[model samples]
Structure formats: structure tokens, C-alpha cells
Target chain A: MRNSFLTVVIFAVLVSATYFYLKSPEIVQTKLEVLKENYSKPRDKKPVDHSKFEVLQKQFNSPQEVVKTCMSCHNEVHKELLDSPHFRWQRPVYENGRGVTYLGKANAINNFCIGVQGSEVSCNKCHASFGEEEAMLAIDANAENIDCLVCHDNSATYLKGNNMNGFPDKSVDLAVVAKSVGTPTRDNCGVCHFFGGGGNNVKHGDLEKAQFHTTNEIDVHMADNGGNLICIDCHTTENHNIKGRLFTVESSNTNRVSCTDCHTELPHESTVLNEHTVKVACQTCHIPTYAKVNSVNTNWDWSKAGKLDANGKPFETEDSLGDHVYKSIKGTFEYARNKKPDYIWFNGTAEHYLLGDKISEKETLLVLNKMNGNYNDEFSQIIPVNIHYAKQPFDPGTRMLIQPKLAALAKGEGAYWQDFDWLKAAEKGMEASGLPFSGKVDWFNTVSYWPINHMVSPKENSLQCVDCHNSENSRLAGLNDFYMPARDKYELVDTLGNLMILLTIAGLFAHGSLRYYFAKKQK
Target chain B: MKEVLIYKGYERFWHWTQAVLIIFLAVTGFEVHGGYSFFGYENAVVYHRYAAIGLVVLIFFTAFWHFITGEWKQYKPTPQFVKEQIEYYLLGIFKNAPHPTKKTVLSKLNPLQKLAYFGLMVVIIPLLVITGIIYLFYRMPSATNMNPLNLTNLEPIAILHTIGAYLLVMFVIVHLYLITTGHTILSNLKAMITGYEEIEEDDDHHKKEEKKV
Candidate 1:
């Protein structure tokens, strides 16, 4: 009896200790404390608070002055920044016909506003430079041109001037931003990134403003109530070259990040689930829907742009969902929210269609950049992507995709926004890009794929077995190379198997019945 | 009363455990094969794996027992009463003809029982176990790393395991029926359960006092 009492007392103490262990603050509330939209910056770590530095005290004349002062102390870092793609907006790529060709956003044509050749003043707002950074023509960027305050600002209030040649807005306090420089936060990177392709959540469907301060339900890594990871956390950088590459612009697969970087080769505890990781990417299952909070530009038709109202001015109209469906300067658009992605086998390499490349196919939807992989490829896995489709102009005679000059510095400059003429703008843009325009505009359907890489839901919200294992319209319904047990079966084999089982049952019944009848007669 | 020890301790223990495990595996296994959704797919897969491992363990113990005690010879079908045993099951049993082969402690199984058990031991059971193990362990051509066994596709192994399972089910049904064909309908079952059987040696076929060994 005494030993039994001692055992019970020991068990009680163990239970009490475990109960209090979970009740401790660190274990329960760390997830909340570390993740707020605008959490208090750790000023203690700023040993050199630039607020006291005399170099930043006199930055008053212009945005260039702020850059000169920033370079006064950080010239070495600024020099590295100038060589980055973020600064020059171009990179050297090894192409098929041309061994090593220089290409970038400046000359490369997308299904969106075509190219940045003649729209430098407007597009350079997002470019990582101070002023006049156009690489279509030779770029003259140096250490003084590097925009350090844009990426390193922790103040989260720096705004770039719209259509002002990459300068900060006139209202921005250059001294205040210079005094508060630190490592880039989600707010700093997201200021331009979340607004890529002109507006919020329009370029990559998975990236949006909601990610700046969302809960774990939308994005587990970047959510204000989740891991609160910044851009550079996974896209790690060395000497200003980010590790991750986007398939939309990049051609090489050398620089990429994967879930296996931190997780095990087989992350799932169950072997059944781990078996799937070989043929399926983590993002394919983790990111079930893209554009979770805002509507993304799924369709854009440039043919409908320049539609002036009776008052002779371009006007904007909103759809019933309050999303802009018609921007007279950009055209008719179709936006989609919480959209399921198109699944494709991608081995991470992509082949982009460079400008001046002839298109031989007629009356077909052109893929501007096609992801490279097949079911037979050893390195391929099913990945989810958002295909943004568009109807844009191309040269009918030259069979080349046309890039129209979309912005103007002055009136009647042959820019599409000023003259409202496609042929004239195409001529000017082609002249800038050193490509020929056929003097005729014909719009064709084009698409660019953007792989979903963010807004991962919680583990509890992962796909259940039936999501892909069901017979009807499975998420992987398009992938049919191999036999998936629940989702695939040979109809003939199944019928024969069921019939054989049935025949056995029938035979057993008949034999058992006969035995019972004969035995009853004898009895 | 005349009673004899028909089954040893380990034999009875192994047989009942194997029986329970096989039945449970069938229920869960068919569900995993998309036959029905009783336990749900995930639970069915998990439970089927556990029970399959249990069956493999039980088979190991049974093999050791059979080898050590030399009880494996009991499943060898004897040529002496093979014809008479078949005729008895087909025609003699309904007309009250005496059992063609007498039951003894050394030769507990009848000629027909010997033949069926022998077939099951060598063919159907081995087929099921071998194919099931391959199906469980086989990997695709390059799933994780290099496949050591060089077994690529799972289609053939899956179909073969499925056919083996169906045949095992058929054998079980027939075996359950044959157990009732003893002196009384429950006598064979009682012998298996209690490890004792009372056989009347006289031709009268009436109830008699019994002694159990």
C-alpha cells in the first residue's frame, strides 16, 4: 500500500510538471510576439544609429544627394549593388543561337506593357537606381547611382516618385530615411515587389499587399502572425546576388531554393506521403490557391486600351467586385481571386522567347516563356503555376512580338499614352529596341507562367488524400503517366477482378446449398 | 469418454492469431484497394501496414514451431485414403457412412484435409505472403535514391497480390465449411479450440463415453 501511494505521488508530480511546462510563456506565445505587421524594430542592435552620424545630417538638396551621402560611407556595398540585376535591370545569358547574349527587362518583351524600352521614366520607379537607369541603351550606372536607402530602409515610409525617373517622391524626408537605415524588411522589399506589373498583386498571383500583415492562414512564412520571414531569409544573398531566380525572366536553373534546404529529403512522417515528394513539389500541395486576399490580373487585352469617353479623356471603370476591369490607358482586364493553379511538370529550367526571335506559327497562343520538363525527366516534379494570359500586339509581316512605347515625356512624342496610336508607338519602341516594326498591328493571345511560391497555408490546411486521389477532376487530373492507386485503375482489370470474386461467392453458395438439401433429406 | 490431443499449444495459438490477423487485414486491405470507405483511406493504409507486419511476425513464429516440433509432416497428404476421403465428403457423409480415415493423435488430419492444407501451405499462402511483401517494399525506378532490388513498376506485383488475397478468401470459406463435416457439426471446431477430440471407435455411431489424451 505504501509503494502504491509512492507510485501515485510520483505520477502526479510528473503530470503537474508537464502541465506547467506548456503553461510557460515562451512555448505558447512566441509565435505571436515575433510576428506583427509593423513590429517594434530592434534599435538595440543598431550600434551605429546613423541618426548621430554627421554624414547623413546634411542630406537636403535632392534624392541624389542622399545617395551621395549614403555612398560616402558605403561605397564598397554600393559598387556591388551597381553590378546586380536589380540595379542594371539586365543580365548576361547564354542563349541557343547567340552563345552569350545580354538581355533584361529593358529589352525583353512581356505580355504586359510590352517592354520598358521607351517607358524608362515610368518603369524605373521600381528599378534599384537613383536616376536615368536605362539598360536598353548602354547603362552609365556607378557607385553614386546605387540606391541604398530603397532596400536598406527600416523606416518603412520611403516612396519612389511615379514616372519621375527612379527618384524618391518629393514628399519623402531623405534625412529621416537615411538616419533609420537597416536590413531590408518585408515592407521594404514589398513596397516595389508587391506592386510589380503596375499595381498591387498583379504580377505574381501569390505575392500581394495582404502578405505584409496577414495571419498564418494566408502565408505561413511571411504572415505577421506566422514566421514573419523577410525576402532575403530564403532568397539568401551574397555580394548583392540573390540566390533564388524567377522562371519568368531567368533562363538558368543553377540558382534556386527548395523546401529541402531546411526540411529532410522526406519531410512527411508517413512513408505514403514521403513517397509523393519524389514526384510532387512541396509548393504544389502547400499553396492550394494563389491570390488569397486580392484579385490578380488573370487576363489583359491591349486591343481595348485607348478607349476615350465622350468627354475625350481616358477613364477607369470598376467591375461589380470593385476590381478595376477597364483602365482606359491599359485596357480590359479579368481579375481572379483565390484561384487554383495550373499544374505542370517543371524541372526548374525555363526557355524564354527573346525579342527579334521569329515566330513561324500562325494564329496560335504564344507562350512567352515555357517551363522545361516532361514526365520522363528524372528531375521533374509537378509544380503549380499561374498562367497570366493576354492579347497583345505583334508584327504580322515581321512575325515578331511588338513592343509599344507606353509613356511620354512630352505631348505628340509618338508614345502610346500621348499619341494614342499603336503603329507610331510600335515604331518608336522598335527604333529604341533596334528591331523592325511591320507598320501593322495584329493582336495575338500570349501567356507568361508565374510559379506560385508564397502564401503557404498551415500544415493542418494541407491537401487531404481525396483531393488528388479521387476519380473526378482531381488536382492532378492532367498528369496521367503513371498508375496512382485511388485515382487510376484499368477498368477491364477491375471488372474482371470483381467478377472472379463474385463467381467464387456464387460457387460457394451453390455447393453449400446442395450439401444442406442432401443432408436434410437424409435426416 | 475417449479424448485425444489433436493440436499442440503453439499450433493452436499460432492458428487463431493468424486467423484473426488475416481477417482484419482483409477488411482493411480491401478498403485501401478502393473497395469501400469504412476506415477511410489514410487509416486503412496505416492499419493494413501494421497488420501485415503482424502477419509476417506470426508466420516467423509458426515456421519456427513447425520446424522444431516436426509437426510439419502432418500436412503431408497420404496416398492410402485419398480416394475414400473424397468419396466420403461427396457421397458417404449424407448417407451416414463412417469417416473414411480414422482420427489419431499422430495423424490428426484426414486425407482430404491433408491435401488442402498442403496446397495452402506451399502455394496460396506463400504466394500471398511473397507478393504482399514485394508490393509493400518495392519502389519506383528512381523514387528517392538508387533502387537496390531493381524492381521498377508496381502493376504486376499489385495484381498478383490482389489475386492471392482473393484465393485466400476462397480457401477460408471452404475451410470453414469443412470443419462442420466432423462427427457432430461442432466436433472439429471443439477439437481445434480445446485441443481434444472424442472419437467413437465402434461402428454404431452413437454417443459414447470419451477419454482425452
Candidate 2:
């Protein structure tokens, strides 16, 4: 009875401890929430005369506010900032705007710079550090505009001065700027462009190391073509406005000059052209468009359209276009919407449509050159002319340049035109004969194009080899005109007949070896 | 004296063949698992796969022979020396002690040995074989279906195979050490070679011998 009581007492203590342990997490969470709610909604209570705290806050605010106050005198710098791509961003909002977010907008920058862009709150902190001294700015007034020396000053060494603080008032703290200015390093850029957050997406491939601020000795992209180009080179301020040029191409809607504008040459060497010549234009292939492709996020509903039922019946039909139609259908009348490539099959129109007038090969080259001038960086296309000419005599207006056979043939080709050379043979043959190759080449003709296939099907170039030759025919054909050439042919017959002699010898040797082994075993 | 060969020539042949093959597999298996590179990784994988297949075939044949010869009775574990044998390995081995039980033609293994061998044959080997075969024919991921072979973490099967190999290696190290602790230092090794062992006659065994005479 005593032992049982002791066990019960121990069990009671364990149960109490366990109950408290499980409840602690919830209790702590509730207390933390309560504190947060109280702090967020500050109420008017008994005012304490906190003079010392106010003095400390004033000192910090005075020096930091210098950048904003100086902006009044240096109005040019402020104007240039308006033209920057950063202007697209609205003031840093907590979670609403499309700017950088601290909670991390899905693919955008992190939460820290949610409101600010170029001259926004966070950027101004580090950027305006060079314009600290009034005497320095008086000597070179333009230095206050960009102040590239703040970060990129390579000859700089550590020194002592005011650490700027505050947003609007102009005052300087005396104690903190006491250290020497360290050598300009990539770490300076890392202050903004680390891990691609905070609205500063400086792409240099190797994100672990900051490549923008410092004179990165090693070219991250092209080791050989490494030039001493700074951010201002690509991002130049025009009209006292920190603005970059934007291309008028229908594709790129944003404001910024493309790197390809100056560096007309591709970073890597082109396979088709030598170093001296320019071959394929970059814009012709990787053509940019202002509108994004495939804008719809979800699948479509087709049940709402009022149309005919399967068997000559009228009903409601909802096509993928999101439009309702009431119709009657007896035959399989196909429909297409949105001009998507796959939807073309149901359009009931011919395969492909042409756009422009047909031009000769020489004219095509001239037109290409005209559309894409030597220095101009843009893409041009003459789709209608080229497409119509390719499918000749098919009522060029009504006939689409749909190469049904060509599309089927091109299916398994590697990314580049794999079987283009083979297809060129047929094109060349027709061109050489100067005759019209009327219809498309069928599957059989495509496969049986080889010379070996021609012998098999003499009528259609399939693979038949024994059509003209046999052993009896060979003998007759060899003796030309039946004249005195029979001795060589008859004597040469032993060459093909030697296999019988060899087999007889092999059989005898096998028989003798077996007999000897069996006889020895018996002994 | 009735002359008794505890192990037959074929039995020893199968024993050594399996041991050598298992050791080869373990070495190559570790190399394939990127533990270290003695042979190149690809070659080691090929060699390990071939050795594993041969070991499986050898095990199949060995099991068949054991059943046919009624030698499967040798692995039947009992309470005989169950505690003493555990004590022998745990503490008595260092003191130059005699074995708790003797090996005879009828019963060559102690209870501990029987249980370990039975566990290895029934549990570990089957697990390794089944997992290995499934891993070898694993399919690529598809749009319609998830990965066909669903191992817990998608860790490469070679890692699991390497774990099995390490377990086998530990077993081998203990086995080799045990083989040396016989009537004489090299007596067990020699017995395996000559199919005979000079077992020391204890008081009970000697009395039984005299009674038989």
C-alpha cells in the first residue's frame, strides 16, 4: 500500500510538469501578441520629459538630412533622377506596390526597399555620402550629382569625419567618421546589390561577389574583352537628368539603353562569320516584343456557347474564345480563336497565310539591308512576300505558304535545320531544270531519294538490287559479242568453288582428333 | 578414435568463394558510392553489379546444397551455451579463455553464431537483394505518374548498398578475429584447409570417448 502511494505521488508530479510544459508555448505566444498590439497602437499617456533622448535623436537626424536639403541647391541631380527607370516605382509601400518588398515579392527584390527606387530612402543613405563636405562640392559642383567617388574612389584611404544621419535637416555627427576611408572594393556594391534584393538587381553572374562598385579586374563575362567601363558608361545622365536611352522597338517598353546598341558584336564569336565580318543580326532571331506571349493564366470554359449539337441540331455552344454563340451545324465546321499556332488547324482556312509582295533572291537581300541599316539595331520581317513566293501558282492571295510535307519532315531535326541540306537537293533540282515542281513530295519519295533505293524499285526508286543481274546473266554478259573471252571466265570459276575443298579437310581433321582422344581414353 | 571431418571440401570451397566474392563486392561497392577512388567510379559500379549477381547465384546454390545434404540442421539455435557464448565474446576472449562450446561434425556453430547467420540470411540479405533489384530498374520521372520507385528520400540506392556493405565488413572483421581463437592460433585456418581439426578433449568429451570404447 505504501509503494502504491509513492508511485501515485510521482505520477501526479509528472502529470503537473507535463501539463505546464505543453501549455508554455501557447502562453508565451499570447503574451508576445498582446505586447505587439499595445506597441503598434500608441495612446496618449502621461508625458515624461525625456530631454536627453530628444537631444540624441536630434544629433543623428541633423547630419543625415543634409542629402535631402542639398538637393534644393543641386536641382540638376534631382531632375536627372526623374528620367531614370527607377521612376516607374512608386513610394515604398508595405505590401501593395510593385516595388521591392521586405516580405519578398515572389520574384522581385526583398522587403527592405519596398517603397524607394533610385533616390528613395535606402539608396540615398549610401549614395549621398560623397556630397558631405560643402567646400568639396563648391570646387566641383557636378561632383554632387553622381558622386562616383563615394564608392569607386580607389586611391581613398581611411579618414575621420561626420557620419551622415537624418532625412531632411543638415547637421553632422563628429565622432563616427574617425576611421580612414578604405580602398574602393566590391564590398561597396555589396552594400546594395547582395543576393539580388532591395530593388538593386546588378547582374554579374557571380552573385556571391559584388562586381559593380569596384574596378573588377577580371571580366566576369568576357575575360579577353575586359574593358574599364563603369556604371555611368551604360547608365549616362542626359539633360542634367539621370536618364538612360530607351529603344523604340515595339518589344522593350521599359526605359533603358540595351548593351547591344554599342557592343554591336555578340559577346561570343559567331560560328558562321569570321572576326572581320558581321553575319546574322541578333535582333532578327531573338526579336523582342512589347506584349508578353500567352497572357491568359487559366484554361477556358467552352460549355456556354450556344451552337448546333452533333446531329444537325441547334443548341448553345461555348468555344474557347469565352464568347457564347447560338448556331446550327450539320457538317464538321472547325473554328479557331486568338491566332495561336495550334488553333490554326481548326480555322477551316488554308494552312499558312502570306503578307507581302514576292521578291527575287537579289531583291530579298536588298530589302533586308534596307530594313536593317548597317548601324541600326532592330528586327524587320517580309513575311507575306517570302511566304507567297514559296508556294507558286496556288492563287498567291488565297493560297497560304503552308508546307505540309516540309513540316512533317522537319519534326525530328535537331534544333537547327538538320535535314535542310537534303531538302535543298530537291529545291536545287527543280531550280536547275527551271520547271515547276507542282505538288508536295510524299513520304515514299522522301525516303526513296537515295541511289541504292532506285535499283530496287526501278519505277519509283525503291531498293531492289537483283533486277538486272544473276549468275546465268553474268556469264552471258561477261563474254562480249561471244568472242574468245571464255577461257578466262571458265578458269576463274575455281576462285568461287574453293569453299567445298576447304570444308572437306576441316571435317576429316575433326573426325581424326575425336577418334584419337576416345582411343587414348579407352586404353 | 572416430575420425571426423567437420567441414567437407565442397563446403569449404563454397565458404571461401562466398567470402572472397562478398569482400570484392564491398570494396567495389564503396568505391562506386564515392567513398574513395581505387578503381574509377564507373568500372567499380560494373564490377560490383557483376559480383552481386554472382553472390546471389552462389547463395541460391549453397542453400540448395544445404537442404539436399540435410546440413540445414547445423544452423538450428538452442539454449546450449547461449549465455556462456555471449560472455565468451564480451569478456572471456581477452583472458585467453576456452570456448563455451565445442565444434563437432554434427553441430559446428554455437547458438550465437547460428542466430547471427540465420538473421543475416533471412533478413539482411533478402532486404538488400530486393532493394538492389528495384533500384537497378528504377524509371525516369514522367508527366502522368510520379517516380515509379519510391524510396523515402530519393537518395541514390548506391548509398544504401554502401551501408549494407559496411555492415557486412563489420561482420567479416569479427568473423576473422573469431577464426583465430581456436585450439591453437592457426588451428581453425588449417582445419578449413585440411578438412580436419584437432579439438582438445574436455573432461566430459573424454569420458564419453572412453565409454564408447
Cα RMSD, each candidate: 7.0, 30.4
TM-scores of the candidates are 0.85, 0.29
lDDT tens digits, residue span B1-213, model 2: 233677886677668778888889867765544325666544565566666666666677678778988998778666656799888765565555667777677667777989888877876687667667665544322221323663332244544543455556656665776676666668888888777887654468745633332
lDDT of 1: 0.77
lDDT of 2 by residue, A1-523 (tens): 3643453465446545644553243211223334335434533232432222322233323332433433544455644433222321211222212233221111121111111111122233443333323211222334334332234333233221222211221322311221212223444434433323221221111222323332222231211223333344444445433323211101122344443444443332321111111312222122111011111111111112124347634454445644332222111112222111110000000110111222332321111111111111112111100000010111123221112111112324311122222233233333322334334431110000000000001112211111111233321232232111111123222333234435544644554455446546656
Kindly report which residue stretches of model 2 are placed more than 4 angstroms away from their true locations once superposed.
Answer: A1-523, B1-3, B90-97, B142-160, B200-213
TM-score of 2: 0.29
Instruction: Return the number of clashes found in candidate 1.
Output: 7
Window of ten residues with lowest summed lDDT in model 2 chain A: A446-455
Instruction: Indicate which candidate wins on TM-score.
Output: 1
- Segments of candidate 1 deviating more than 4 angstroms: A1-44, A93-104, A137-140, A266-268, B74-127, B140-152, B181-183, B198-213
Q: lDDT per model, in order?
A: 0.77, 0.36
